[model samples]
Target: DIRDPARPKRLSAVADSNFSFWHSASFNNDGTKMLFTDEWGGGTQPRCRATDKPEWGADAIFTLTNDQMTFRGYYKLPAPQTSQENCVAHNGSLIPVPGRDIMAQGWYQGGVSVFEFTDPARPREIAYFDRGPIDATKMYVGGSWSAYWYNGYIYSSEIARGLDVFELLPGGLLSQNEIDAAKLVHFNELNVQDQQKLVWPASLVVARAFVDQLERSSGLTTDRISAVRQSLTAAEQASGMARRNALTQLATQLESEAGGSSDGAKVRMLASEVREIANVAR
Candidate 1:
């Protein structure tokens, strides 16, 4: 705890045999989990080739409890890079997707990768952007040095190519609703290393995002999912007291359904969001 700047207390420290050099660290939105990157080759060696071990030069996920950290798992770029590309974990920042633990990280000469570690033990990549090595036949250190999610887009700082901006497209893994919901979060200033807590506004889009998650997890029945879609559509079309009434009704129904839902916590959250939206409806 850093409550006292004059005398900062050390919580805990950990190490892994697979990790060569600890480069940087970041926390999840709630700080319940932390991720550390391993700069195995110090950003100047081919550490992501087919023969390279996945555990080396990868990301380590850990869960934090009462300021103490415990190792959970590791995550590395799945695609193998050529020997000519000097690649290893670099820098990244959390993507505010609400209720999920996701990040956009950069790898030297390996490009940018967006992945989720909600499970911690089994982190998986959802999207990525990469370019071939600056020189196909020779190793030239040139790739994303840092990739951070700010506002609604990912801004990457390339070593030799300058800046690159990326937008998440709708796909099987990530829905447009989830992307839209993520865009709702805004930050005036961000320091990826400092790690900030993410707070999403209570809006219909957020509620819909939750519904989409429920569908993905099979947390809600198909009939209930369709009903929610129709109700949200109806509420959006209405105005004034009509919209408020519709949303209020839907929120109440959702709250009642939570008792039987497999993901009751998420259902309650969705209900709370809808209730807040109803309150703000003019």
Candidate 2:
């Protein structure tokens, strides 16, 4: 859009019907979508309070089509804040989730939230980090001002506190493989306004991440886990079709046993990834 910076052109104007006040905006990789924030109350009041409307101070995701933007949906911080907490939606940036649309955002005292907007109509939060309000007695007018994902880490500019750094850890809503895949992206310069899409390379790290998740969740049996580790180790050291077949066979066995386990769905899921990894390794 800024092809001619000397005479910048305004392609669109989102008026009051969309939000009360627009604080900041970001574009997804590929520039196919744009996400805007509604800093209701000018970000100095408790706009994230229980009494506030979901759209009053939230991030709205919009898809770009034919040079036109269409409203998708809103992602407000789920946690309710008290009048004493100066909470409201603020700044955010994308988290590189291969094959998916994910973002890490800050909501003043509402805390840091990493979520998925792949399906703009229904965005979901995956991981988060927040502390007790700055002051439980009064509105402190302080919290996270910005949270952006760059390279392999998420950098947050705290209003009162100095800069803070965060890393994505495996959680209920996000798998380790997904997180690892995201980290493959590296941006030399990340200007919030000039957003860019993230692209991740396909590699063994992804497959190993899936193994780590299954190991942590006890999705695999002890013996199966050992076998999987061994096969993966040998395959990494091997450079032949036999290694690929070995991994494939292991994946097949895991898949076959998945339906019989309590965590069958997850097991089957991991097996599929492992299968793909074998093909790549071979």
Candidate 3:
């Protein structure tokens, strides 16, 4: 089922009765359709241990229309258990490349499988990355959860570990050369807490300072500045340390840009007023 966040509308029940157990779903580039993963065959329950039944661990990706929520078709995973147990595509995302559709799906005990979805209805398996032998029976099994493309690199969130960074390269399907090039960097290994605390506030302050300078140089009206101030006020009202800190940083930037006893004297006065509000919020 899909819901329009902006409108009071819903698109639901696009699949047959056979598609009951599903773990995740992702939208195509144009937002016209979506691809969903079904964990088990029709009647099988979630996290089942019975090997007598056809394992039903095979994963299938289905395409559905966005406007009408109609089922277009499906692409089933090829057979043969690559690992100790059967494969299951759990959580994944679709990357939109011009003239091509790429899908990155999480496979329990199968790692991250990247598929070429040129034909939205029938996707082809292109490449995959398997971390190592994963005991799916174990309580604390590790695997990929979410995959996204940012700054020309594929960033995947590991179950327990932080983020695993990968870069796509030209190579065969299971080529270790490309995998070696795609290194995994641990975000938690860095100063995570400190970095998190500075990111939002730092961004807002820098942006506000840049805009203020540009406005001063161009002799533009204070309308834009006033809008930004109002934004900061709203951010301060948000019930989160990160938001309040960001608003405070914005206030500081306004104060710094507003110099003393000069053409910016009025701006300086407004900055002081904003600072007082920020101080109370903090």
lDDT tens digits by residue: candidate 2, 1-282: 679989888787665474888888877777788788888888888888788888778888889987888988998888788888787788888887654578888877777888888778898888888885888886687788889888889998888777889998877667777787878888788886666656555466666665665665687877777877787787788777877887788789888989877667667766777787777764
Cα TM-score per model: 0.95, 0.73, 0.46
Candidate 2 has an lDDT of 0.78
CA lDDT for candidate 3: 0.50
Q: Measured by C-alpha RMSD in angstroms, how accurate is candidate 1?
A: 1.4
Clashing pairs in 3: none
Best by TM-score: 1
After best superposition, candidate 3 residue 64: deviation in angstroms? Answer: 5.2
User: Relative to the unseen true structure, what is the C-alpha lDDT of residue 6 in candidate 2, on a scale of 0 to 100?
Assistant: 92
* Candidate 2 Cα errors over 4 Å, as ranges: 6-13, 16-18, 206-237, 240-282
Write the residue-wise lDDT of candidate 1 on 64-97 in tens digits: 9987899999999999999999899989988887
Candidate 3 per-residue C-alpha lDDT over 174-281 given as tens digits, one digit per residue, 9 for 90 to 100: 233223322222233332112221111222233344334334444224775577657765674575566667666766766776653243644553455455545555
List, in order, the clash count of every candidate structure: 0, 2, 0
TM-score for candidate 1, please give it.
0.95
